[model samples]
Target: MSTLTKQDPFSRLLESAPTNFTAARILAKECYLAQGIPLAKAEEYKFTNVGKKLEQNITNFFNADSFEVSEELIKSSIFEGFKGDVLVFSNGKFLPAHSAKIKGIEVSVLSEKSDLALGSIAKPEKDPFAALNQASFENGIFISIPKKAQILKPILLLFFNQANEGQVIQPRVWIEAGDFAEVTFIEQSVSLGETAYFVNKVVELKGGINTQLHYYRLQNEGKPVLEVSNIESDIQKDARFTSVTISLSGDLVRNNLSFNLLGSNSEGNMYGIYLLNGKSHVDNHTNVDHTIPHAESHELYKGILADQSRGVFNGKIFVRQDAQKTNAFQQNNNILLSDDAIINTKPQLEIWADDVKCSHGCTVGQLDEEALFYLQARGIDKMQAKGLLLYAFAGEVLEKIQEESFRTYCDTLIQERLGSKF
Candidate 1:
């Protein structure tokens, strides 16, 4: 891979796009100029070359001008049996006409005067993709839940993308939950056409004291899309935050998830499931920081790869010196169905507190032939036996989902991906 210079297409695109949040944009621009995009040689990005993928797949990095969504498309795209407030975005632009009136929550578009806590959790200086988002994002949404507010229905964020040519779309989201508030957010992306596109998304979340926040992301954009997403959250005293990511299909996908336990007695949970086939590629990098004492974090990610697809996972847990009595656990497991499939997993733990308890481990293997044979001996078909085993393996993470409708939706998708109706 060659070095990213001023003459590169990405740099030119960055120079041409309009800036948002002036001060932060300037800082992000400076950072981009200083470090440029990460190459394959970079340690943090050794397994996946996101910069190269963006350069090759995206022709117009700043063209999201067309915003059109038919009524039929909107009606057919929503999840079945879902009862919730919906926010619709077409080609990275919010459409109020198609959105529902949200109750007990404040929602608005991001603007120059919007009081933002954007750069506090996910710093622009640390991530180049996030910096690009801060510098070039034209429109975004901000959600605020007041103290003691408990929303019974989940908030659905629907993103629909369609273009005649290859373009890059940037969508930004900021969520703040006040003390003792409870809310759940579900994000789903749909591609309206077969045209190649790139999506760069950044989300920032803040949880106040005793708050409970749940976030779920579903990516099924098919094989013509490349996506890079970043989500950073901060949890306060006695707060509980949970995040679940499900990736079913994509050409090239990379997700960065981070959590900061800034207060004592806080808890953070991360769960992910990726089922890839064809030439698809998916990478997930996560970090959990324990800055105070008596905090806990747990992470479990599982993947199933078939054909010539590839998967990567890197999870890290950090315990600071002052974070005594901290408990952190991380694990990654994968099952490769084909000989050509590949998976690289690394689970890491860094501790500076002697009183902390931390453990990290990873495993990559194929299906158990003995288990398959035993199922077949019991009169189950070969295909059904395989599907049952794989489904049972994935159920460990699927059961973590709290919502019934969403869990069923995910279960159906997983079964379809496995090529079996069981």
Candidate 2:
């Protein structure tokens, strides 16, 4: 047995997992047993020790009998001013009562009869968290958008975690958009109690030709929660896929986002922002692969860390030999607000095509003293001045959000996290 399997939480989670989705579950279990959990020495997890965090924080699998979702709790969890389809999950179990139905789109729980492209894009064999989620997820959500259908309203997925004891929750989401289909998705997570818990989430998205898919994720759980999420997407010919991740607070958080441009003329955009304070820690890792000619990808991630917080950003762009004429750009920037705050940023580009345009860069520094002096000279208080500059620095990535209401909502959260009155 591996060291991970000996852990109480991992063992209990495996033993409690349902035997449904046998094929995928067996494969994922085998892969997880072979790979175990990544250690600090591993190249992919050098900066962020997720395994240690999980071992230290999580104690057991969630006990469903310990908590129940109330109507008031559901109401309070809904996003303000958002009138769209909502799918609510409490303790990783889907709640049909609190969800709304939408026309022209199919939403259902994962089952044997479901027409699923489960392992098409996401390879659990390569990622331990994904493998654990695939092996242990109770019942995940599956969404399908028919060909040529355009849904104007964005779909919201709300995940709430509440437990009396330290536990673990695994949530899985699979989305497929047929050719020429267009849709948007918003995923938000909330913790209901002060107890420490672990959430391992995996999302797989498949886009068909000429399809447009937008995904936005918000992580603002309490400081006692530890979260690790993976989002994998594949875009076909003429399709455009955009993803935005905004992380506000958590004890330990890691986001792994990847996009594969599988067809010509496909485009992918990734934007992320993390505002961390206290002893919070957040890490964002993104990968973009251009496998065909005429594909394009853009990535931008920024962070504002204060107190004893720590942040990490690792982004890579790969252009294969056949990916001629591909254009890719990547950038990561961070600001450390205190001497104890730390950030590790790495932007990498690997291009084998001679006819491609690619660039990658990263920056880590404190707030510009000259700019702060100028603001202070204008009679603005130091705190407000610092807020203004940090907000401006973070606004670049926030502006990439195309949805107006959602953008305003995110702006509000950022301001609050920054403690900016202006």
Candidate 3:
């Protein structure tokens, strides 16, 4: 039998907790105990080795140690000098002193007192990471905007993993947008001092009538790190929500994203880009639920894997019987740099409404040889030719980035990965 078949640390951790009152907590425990570490036997996780790695390193999974987050360190982590309401957290604890509060914006630190309310807003019952985050995390940032309020500037939620002594750290963050409110939020993760850490994060968002939200997440952790993130959002009538995830770093990473269109005329867009090299592995699984009529959703995920890295994309869209006018579309595309690189792409649509329009498709292949040949024929070196093609392949998604600075910044990073200059 595989070692992953043994008891899981998450299982033991939850069982040891003093009290478990919520259904989510109970479900988390049950899922862990029953599945232990996901392995090849678990069809859903068959293409990845996350379970095996966790089992081998299970001994030191949650080792907590003290670390510091200086102002200089926080400043250095910001992207290209653009700043707004910044909230800094170190080792799973919120640093109010480092947080900046803006006018008309409400931000608070979450505690046990807000669990029930958060649970209701978050709907932890559906996501395992959300449940685990609720049970393990003590302090986090809670952001809310009043009706018709507009956040002129962006909000940056920075999470610094300073577990220099090599411990597991969990970060839970919640964001709420009231009726007709508009805001752009950014979530960033960074680790310093070569620490071995695990950051399990949960993000909950809500969009009210005519509201709009833009969420961007960038994950950059040190080598030998494991990170799991779950983001769930509920959309009301005529609201729109867009979420973009960019995974630039981490040894192993998984993102669970879900959206429920509970009101008619609501819209949701999910976008993700994962660049992996060496033995790194990244997985993105997204679900879009159409529970009402006239709801629409669109998902596009692209991945680039080099060397022996692996990527996985699983997207599911569901249209309920009452969702007669729902329109949903999903597509996943991948590029493999080496023959040994692997990618598993699965796109599914489950529609119970006959009047709905839904379509899903996935593609996994190497860079276009014709494009590479054309570039090389123009006197460009083979390496440069390949890099150019890669840039163009990812350019489709990069164009969707609204902010010029962030878009250019991402292009430069992608160029570096493609062995070129932007």
Candidate 4:
């Protein structure tokens, strides 16, 4: 995926006389050629050295003709208590046989005509990964909800990568919620084991007038995986869009999330929790654009780094000049347990409207010894008290989830990740 020079991997790919190239792919290729991959030195990607990783594993492109999915794998992929239509994708290609038949919503593939999906990807001329994904995306899902539809159940997108040959997996998803519609979507990326694999994922969210949509993503890839993902959203008038990302395990993971409040009175809420151990690395960069008046956006992200792992969080909230009376808030907090753990947190706010109220802050610290001691004084052991305090600290972000089962599952996972301190 290196866009460094004329002899980069993508250029080498072009020299191989690639065939069956779609118009979108051609455009993306041109964009990549115009603007190469952003190096680690680049200001935008300075914290995460994705360019270096790509340079090291440049030839691991997608080459599988097809794949086989075991029934046990499918069963294990879905949560035990989750009640929803599971949409399955194996190695970037959608599997209709394993996926449930979605009802009440229209689903299709993203083609050149799908502007709503393609437009959010932006010009690859500036974003190398966007160009790469647009050019290399194998299968993309376009989902549309009808007006006034109250979708009670959730739609789980289970992306399973079976990288036997160490291939590239790019997944793109576009969702459009109709006016006054309410729906929830869960996107979970998983791999069977550790391997030298690269997964590039992009998601587009559109909220219509008065629509309320909940978007949740869980990344549980194994240690041998490197993932780069982006999420773009558009919210309409009186609409409410909420997103939560729970990152558990990955060798190298970077998530770029952005949203635009196009209509007045629209609300956006973004939340994330990342638990990293071993030598894992996870970076979450988020931005919310307020283009309309009277809009509001709130964000909160927390990270727990253990062992020699590292985590980075950069959040931005922008209030346009015309966005008067806007209310925007952002926060990022990190907990470093081991002496070898590292965390970099930055919260940014850009306000051009004089009538708007905006605030941003970030905190990086270890567990409070006083709180642990307080819990220990109440008859709890030291290690157990620390675990309980850690759980309570992380629970501040998890408790906001509306779904009971999903929230419980996340809470349980966090507790398990806390493990035994002693």
The candidate maximizing TM-score is 1
Best-first order by TM-score: 1, 2, 4, 3
Model 2: worst 10 consecutive residues (lDDT sum): 1-10
Q: Candidate 4: lDDT of 156?
A: 86
Output candidate 4 Cα RMSD. 2.5
Candidate 4 has an lDDT of: 0.80
State every prediction's TM-score relative to the real structure. Answer: 0.97, 0.96, 0.91, 0.93
The residue pairs in collision within model 2 are none
Predicted candidate 4 versus true structure: per-residue lDDT over 1-422, tens digit per residue: 34555566655444432333356567777887777777867777878888777667646454333378877888887776898888878787777777777788887655433445364434456467777777766566778899999999988888878675456777777788889999988887767656777887778787789999998888888887888887888899999999999999987899988888999999999999998899999999998999989999999998888999999998988888999999999999888999999998889988888998898998888999888888888888987887887777778788778876688778777787775343
Backbone clashes under 3 angstroms, per model: 0, 0, 1, 0
lDDT of each: 0.87, 0.85, 0.77, 0.80
Off by over 4 Å in 4: 1-6, 12-23, 63-66, 111-117, 121-126, 420-422
- Native-to-model Cα distance after best TM-score fit, residue 200 in candidate 3, in Å: 1.2
TM-score of 2: 0.96
Error of 3 at 43 (Å): 4.0
Winner by lDDT between candidate 4 and candidate 1:
1
